[model samples]
Target chain A: MSTAMGNPTAGASPGASPGASLAGDPYAPQQDTVAGPVFTVTGQDWDAVVAGAAEAEDERVVVNMGPQHPSTHGVLRLILELDGETVTEARCGIGYLHTGIEKNMEFRTWTQGTTFCTRMDYLAPFSYEAAYSQAVERLLDIEGDIPQRAQDMRVLLLELNRISSHLVAIATGGMEIGALTVMTIGFRERELVLDLFELITGLRMNHAFIRPGGVAQDMPPGALEQIREFIKLMKKRLPEYAAFCNANPIFKGRLVGVGHLDLAGCLALGTTGPALRSTGYPWDLRRTQPYWGYDTYDFDVVTWDSCDAYGRFRIRLEEMWQSLRIVEQCADRLGNSEGDPVIVADKKIAWPAQLAVGSDGMGNSLDHIRHIMGESMEALIHHFKLVTEGFRVPPGQAYAAVESPRGELACHAVSDGGTKPFRAHFRDPSFVNLQATSILSEGGMVADVIVAIASIDPVMGGVDR
Target chain B: MTDPDARTDDDKLRAGSRGEAAGTAKQEPKVGSTPQGAERDLGVQEEMPENTVVPAGADSLEVIAVREGMFGVQGSGDTSGYGGLRRPVVMPGASPRPYGGWFDEVADRLADGLGADAQAAVEKVVVHRGEMTIHLRREHLVTTAQHLRDDTGLRFEVCSSVSGVHYPEDTGRELHAAYHLLSMTHNRRIRLEVSVPDSDPHIPSVVAVYPTADWHEREAFDFFGIVFDGHPSLTRILMPDDWPGHPQRKDYPLGGIPVEYKGATIPPPDTRRTYG
Candidate 1:
């Protein structure tokens, strides 16, 4: 393995300057290093050869592990300085997936901004949609006036998103560490949550369901039934994670002490979600600073004292139970508020058309279509204006934050009193948490580097956005 | 499920009259700014005309530019006859004393923490829409941030976000960098803003006080071209290093190339029939 790690520098063309660019060809061997010692030991004398190689203390290897490597979890590049098996220094090269979403949002209207941000963190699209919508609502000064049913529905989506996002984190983490069974079960449970999302919002991922004033539409019939069934199924399936990996000797060996970060380190790095909760801080924004009426929901803030990969895993597992508790409460509230308005009462901001599922697909309800087409020329004009121009937000800035499955996801939305936003910036947790790469991976073995990053669990979409 | 039969003919006639009034009113764009003290009436009315509210208090607004067309259109492309729309671009001004809520307390604590240099360090405090912002001079940003974090009364342990905005019309202070700080201990949030001229757009990095600002400051620098003077390795983060212009600036073009299919060329989104 070390011989393969050592040959790239020798393969560089003669006289190429050290650290010169590969000229946009990613597959080309980096010619930055002088040739180093390489060894091959095939016999029982391997011990003697290893001892001799260990004596060459000045031999250091620079390894670039990603931007394409699978274990790095989505285009995360780790530049590592290794001495033997131990990492001496670690640095991160990111932004491989930058799509300029923030800049694109400036041209679209306030309501259209949700569609762009929902794509930022694809695994937790509802969190981005909710945060951005909350910011827009605050700028409009209608935070307190959001309908109770809408708030309850938002809580339901957010909690379900928490379960789904954490499942991906655990599944991918387990897969990276060679535990394929955990990966399969994690995804299996996640699909159930996605099923509920599909039923409620029509699309499984990047639904763009949550809007500035409220959700795109009211809950479809039978959504509550599926949610209740989901809660019941999760109650039984939740224990399997604890049973399978909680006490398994190998899982503990791989995770118990790897990627250890205490409360102080987490705060300094601005880490949140399970990574921070694992330090036993109980600093979840849902509890510490609630939004979307999360304060009204009854649940415990899950935490573990170990401050390591294993503790983060346990926090995610336990937090799913807590999320189920919130989801059930949201389902109950949704059931009671059956006929209430989901969008705001204001005609200027509320979407003009009422939506209903048709034989073809979702579209404006026939009743609404008839009222506009036949009865009211006024309503038709209003619909055309609102649909094409979108709603204008009063000029100002507001920062709205929600505790996402990842961390403190915030949207700092600024408006110039126009239909479009002047500026909209997201404080995505993946972007902030990835800064801890060096602090977490340095001084650890090469294998543990993967464990450390998997613990961070950054989705490159959110990180690069 | 509102009762469709509940709408009386009289009510429908009244609603129809109001809609026609609005349609005629929209054609002749509303002139003048929103009435002063309108901020006090937020969320009080169920229905409001678009662009009637200035989100901040009247005392804290200064009109920077007068927009001449509706939907932000310029030149001769607008044919909706709403091109007569005229509105002022109101930039938030310095707020007066007795700022409401915990904002006043935070401002006082931040000033006391800065001690002798508080007068020069903090340019002004603006409290708008239940959020507090302390405008700090670029030179004193780090010290002000240190005091904000370490001071007992204001232990803003987390630097939540750093964003940059470019106002080309703001002349000497064309570029603004805003930092959102969260005090987990006190359960309060505050923002610190610093502005520099576009000619010399530099603000001292606060990574020393809040290590988490590392990538955020880089992002601000990459998008808005605001230079963070002491950032460890201030390089483009979200955009490629070879990329030419800061894409988020107001002056930057939203670029897209035309596409041709079946011998017909289609213009890009920005060049299409833009509403804004």
Candidate 2:
């Protein structure tokens, strides 16, 4: 940390407005081109822009692309200073969909925190759910108590979510660059993945089925067969995605040399996942620091040396194939472990809901009710106690990080020996990785900004959450 | 425990491989500024011993523990369903030496790297569960973090995350900033924590050392109002620019409006009855 080095705003000045990078003035001198003029309204950066303009003078305008454009990839706003068509500088403005998820977690119980986390990175909700659940499980000091079947299911679901999420990245990244054909094909594959999710967890999205003690329940009958079918279907579709984008000149040209962020920039900006892997560093948390039995899974950590949008796009394409291999292994494990409890052995932390879908809907199993009401008073009391006042977590904090589709999606759970979370701060990879857009997009053509951001694949729900 | 042991064996083998790879990586043409800890600390403390082995374990000391109430309220909320639950949450005292696997190795490395100021810089070393946390004085955060990064034996190059936790009950220093650092080279992880009193909530930012901390510091400022002394731009990130208060502070309300449905009203959970 540098000290206040004479410049009032350089180091630590309390009043330094962070948004000033994109804080252009609404009433600055304007130069008209397409998308309006570069308004020097931010007032301070004007002189610097003006001074730099003398060296490479043209009509250098500041273009505010989006807090709400279709192609900006979720409500990300880019403030780009264009010298003719080439962008001289860029800055990002985020937090359009701030729901205060971190603050809201304090009001909910430990088991309920999974529901909130899963919603952050919506594309790969299961991984976020796993990270939060794993943290709570660790906080209870019962990471070991979770069953082998439960851990296997977590890996299976997470890898499935990764394929679906990467499909979205390819689909959306293609759509951003006018490759609409690939988008249709990508989402078609995503539909198959989401179908498997619905079959396994009973929800297509935001599945809180991954519980603190273990998963909410065991896999539905023949759910493994559905995954096996999806894997076979996906293995066929994988080459189609590669063939569509890998050969198209328009797609390759927009990505190959454009929006280039070197390996050093990736680290400085905290870029990981595919974007980091594209820089030729196979630093996947699953391989470098394994969690949730990922170490046991067999898969090659895919990497690329190009370090551009093309490299990033290729990595996601290759990663899907790798995810399928992992899923295939999970299906094999599930076959041998039939009727194993998905929930932990301890009755305390595990949610004891019977979860039977009847005429009314999913609710307490009628058999569980009969057993409690007609058979045992102790069973009823235990059910009532666990549900009403959730289990207590020993006072402490633990940070859990998992490799999601975006990057290292992590959560810091603090418990003050209470049933509810004291405070849970999610270190969302989207929020951190979104910072790299400025470093990558600047000094490149204005059109490539979209190419860069789409490759990063940030979900504003995660960023703003 | 069984899983980690097997992973540990795997990690040692991987560490040996990574070490050989790094030796070759150093010879590659300079791409840009290297973020590796050892490379950055090149000449800072060259005189120190290459590596120092932590001696025998110091006998653990006993400190008086207190169960003080937060805001002077003993069991503030109503206690009904959870009344029987008793968990005396104690802030752990300083851990004794020979602190289990890899922890003592890290502490010894930090001591050798920092030299004479090691004792003063490191406020307390707590090894809880299987993880170790090095608590540092607020002013020494950056220097200590640099040492944690640069030391050859303890190269926690990647800072996994930085989170702010407000413990209203912990008097004097109630707000704590925790950093989770990862040593990909050695396949190990450790936590670093720096606490600042609510009266003066300031800790020097480590953005220069770990550029990834840039947005995270802004986020901590937005939610918890922790003033990072050397942060480049300390402004609101997640919150609206004009948002009034730090929302994550324990004193702040959960602020959810009651939901009105068809002929029914359910108050937000915070306003509902709760056990103390």
Candidate 3:
């Protein structure tokens, strides 16, 4: 490696003048004859010089990992410089899934932006909506008076989103490493969760149900029953999922010691969620920086100290069970608040009457309209104004962060004192968590890179949005 | 489990006179953004055509009508008459950076430990909104990045995100790339923004300092037409190489051909269309 040092420009200090080295070299003794009495170089000194020479060697080979390859989880390309299979350097390339959602939000109304944001992190749409809505509501300063029932409903929905997101992580992580059976079981459980969401919001994915002021509407009748059934179903399957994947020798071999990231690397790479938690850091936003009534919830923050891929797997599996516990508690709370209004009574922020198509192809009954219009002029005018024009938000900026299944999902919203936000930026967990990939992939087999990425479990929509 | 009754209601609504009348009438405007004071003064009845005459205390309803793009009014109005509009305020110091000299203070603090290479590399520091971004010279980019990570007071440590933006029409700096850096101990974030001329849009790569920047720099190179000098593999991640201009630029016309959705012809942005 030191052969390159023969060039007069070699090992020169960044700021040193070119003339200074030449002046010093010619004046010095030919072989340092005055320093030692013709002493031969020792084996230790030779080894030290050789090691120093090797440090300056530029022998690493560059390899492109993917833009279309599997194990990337998405359209992620990694440029790795390697000495054999060991990576000397790594670079991650992303933005294949960029859809300009932030710029798109600038053109949309405050309420309409929720619909676009929900599609950002596909696996955890509700969590995305919740963070966006919470920011908008905070800017409006009307979130304080939000109905208790609406708050409870949001908690219930977010917890379910957490479980569904983790299921994807577990299933996909297992599948990426050749554990095909875990994928089937994971999807089967996730389908039940999606079914519950479909019953409430009329869509399985991208359910823009949670809005700025409250949910899109009250839970459909028997939605809680479906949720209860889902909880029971997930509870019974949890053990089977663990037994089929977690306890299997093949699964353990592939995951247990692969992609180990120490706590310092995790922090330096800005990793959060399970990636950070698995590294012995107890930094869950739900516990440390509570939002969306998370402070009121009673649950334990699950953590692991192994800081390896298996630790992440264990943490997520345990987190799913904890989410189920929260869901059951939320269902109990919902039963008590059945008759209470789900949205805040403020007409500016909420729809006048919950509009649903009836048997007669009309939004509301004639009698209902008659009672509202003829009997109460204020109600009639309020309904008309709200239906025609939405509420205006005060111009200011507010940020709201939620403990998403991936990590801290935050929305930074700026209103130009208008009905629409001037700018909306999402601090997506996937974007932050994906930073750890290069660090985890280095010094590991190329196959382990797949497991490391799966453990991170980034939703490309969220990462690229 | 499908309901036949639901289908009959949908058919009736489709066939009803109410639907025909509603379709023929002027379509309702998109909600939000009417001056609140003027809207409240117009009162509730003013929305109806029969009650077009101004009501009592309606002097504040000054309607300045727009003629192009989307037609709308922009003036003071009441909440009810104009759908909860609020007056727009010209906030003081609402430029890109609102925090004034604070960015310079932060940048000066960085000058000491970053060494002369980093100091020479950093050209301008601007504070936009609450975010501070230090613009750097392309040649000294790697040195600056290393200082940001290793320096004690400015231990950015992590490169949280990197993205690119295009301003093709803008002179001097047409290709803008931004790097978001975070210090976990400080729990603070700083942005490193660089701009290169469109003619030769190449900046030094930070991949050596933070490996995560490799993908981000390549993406910038791909979408915004910028290039990273030392990037290992810089190629298009989303669009094909034969693709014309950077799509994200504000001036780049969003056009490709019409997309037919549910029998509705949705023309490209550049197409001329007459909406019924």
Candidate 4:
């Protein structure tokens, strides 16, 4: 390939920074008077350049960390300008995993939207599904008609998802800082939650269980008992994290006062979740702007006063405890909502098939098949029409937000009175909070950049979507 | 930028005033008898007979397009026998006064905040589905945002999201950017929308007011090509830097590349037959 075509920096440069190229590109490469050679700072492969340039006597070296770095989290690439060990500037290169999920949703039916959104934030799939479903329900003018049993089930799933997501955040944060035991134990406890999820929704991740009007179906037999047992197990396993790392001097020395951002900084950068809560402000969407019956839940919005990475870590740990409390309450509620319908009563909006596990694995129940195929021709037509064309939403727009483990995951849905959405946009917290990378890591040590980004815990799936 | 196939599909989905006789086959009597182009002028005067959920008053409704089939099909593939489904794709038009609840209070405060330029700044206030949207001209977007952030009565602290929508039919204003602002102090939310023509898609950047708008604005510009003129870094955030065109625009195809199956080439999604 020609140098112009092989070079990724030949086109537009980032911001107002002059592009760095050896040829006629507007961002021409600057001469390195004392170094090996001057290279453009766009490509992900920079180890060879770094090695050759480091041999020089220069103190200022620009390092291109990975779009594939194991420590920088998912596909995030960090370009750090280091004066020896101190980072003077930091820039994030994202969009390595853009799948155009939002654009794809415009062509599919509204019910099919949940399947796509659930895959956006892979760690917190339930949060995205719930937010999208709530938006669709609001646009359909049937928000009040969602059954109580469905609402309770959503609460149950959301709380469990919160626990699992926070576990991964803490686990990955620990592993990035060389604490492998936390990673091992975190996934161990997370597996129990996943087991319960598998029992309930039939998928460990990307469970499209939440639908537009309600959940896909009611819970199976012994699902509640399994949840009760999981909650009991988590209650015992919860304090092990604090006992392991809370008082560990090495962990505190590595994380304390690293990646510090105050309340004003958090608000300015639109950072929410534990990162914002660590600044001693109790700003949670569930408490301030309640949705999906979260207002009725008995839980506290945990906060830490350090305004640093350690505080954010502590906040996540405490928040997991609070999530466990909410899960307990949801289990009690789900137990009382026995035999209640989980989907809406509106036949037009509700999914017709009552799903059952058959010889073919999972398909429409035999009873529903008999009614639609044998008993009533109208039932067959209704099922076919609803399945193919889906329900229509009135022409308008609604914004629904849910507090995901990361932050506020909001879905903005606009319908032009069609079976599919006219425009749908998700305000992914990972995408927004990631803008704080420079602010958090600029004046900090180069090694602390990992701690800073890990504290934010941005999942690149949500960021790129 | 002006792909003919995309425009045809757009017109088929929302058959604006052009009203080409694409799917005018086997007209059912109950659907409509009004001719294609004349429906735009005549239908604007009376409440649509069907679709009761649409608020009454022809003045409030903006008839984006007049449809003539159950499914938005251009040729003879619509065999559902419901070809005569001629309903105008009507958006909830500008809402009237009283606005209700906190919406009126926000409008009054924003007007006070905008001062002398309030009349020129705000084109209209639309309250739909309990959400308030203040449609503003692109020129006054930054000033209005600053006031909304600083004004004590209207303290929308966090600009949670910035999204772009492309309306190819809305002739002078094909590109729209909506800013969803949340006020943590008052615990309320409001949206501000600005529209610009496709010829000159420029809107003043609100990054100075809301620092969080930096990335969101970049994403919007990458997708819709709406330029936030004063942005610090007006580069592509999602798409590749060398990408040919904005992929999220209505004129851009969904772009499903054909897959090669076992000894056969499967058609792309856009080329395949589709149901409603």
Best by DockQ: 4
Q: lDDT: which is higher, 2 or 3? A: 2
DockQ of 3: 0.10
- Model 3 CA lDDT for position A411: 80
Interface RMSD of 3: 8.4
Candidate 2 reaches a DockQ of: 0.22
Could you tell me how far off, in angstroms, the CA of residue B174 lies in candidate 3 after the best superposition? 12
Q: For model 3, what is the alpha-carbon lDDT of residue B98?
A: 26
Off by over 4 Å in 1: A1-26, A29-57, B1-53, B72-85, B258-267, B273-276
Reference-based lDDT, residue B50, model 1: 44
Model 3: residues >4 Å from true position, as ranges?
A: A1-71, A77-93, A357-391, B1-276
Q: Which candidate number would show the highest lDDT if scored against the true structure?
A: 4
Model 1 per-residue lDDT at A22: 33
Tens digits of per-residue lDDT for model 3 on A1-465? 011111122233311332233334443211212211111222233443333234433434355556666667877877766565576666677777888777666555688889899989999999899989988887677778788889889989899988888988898888888888888888988898888888877789988899888888787889888888888878788998788877789888888878788877775555778888998888787777666577787888999998889999999999999888888988998999987887777777786666565787654756658868789898887876554344556544455768899987878675544455655767788887776777778888767778878888888899888
**Model 2 residue B130 CA deviation in Å:** 1.7
DockQ of 4: 0.49
lDDT of 1 by residue, B244-264 (tens): 989899899888899998999
Question: Which wins on lDDT, candidate 1 or candidate 2?
Answer: 1
A189, model 3: CA deviation in Å? 0.9
C-alpha RMSD by candidate, in order: 9.7, 13.9, 17.3, 7.2
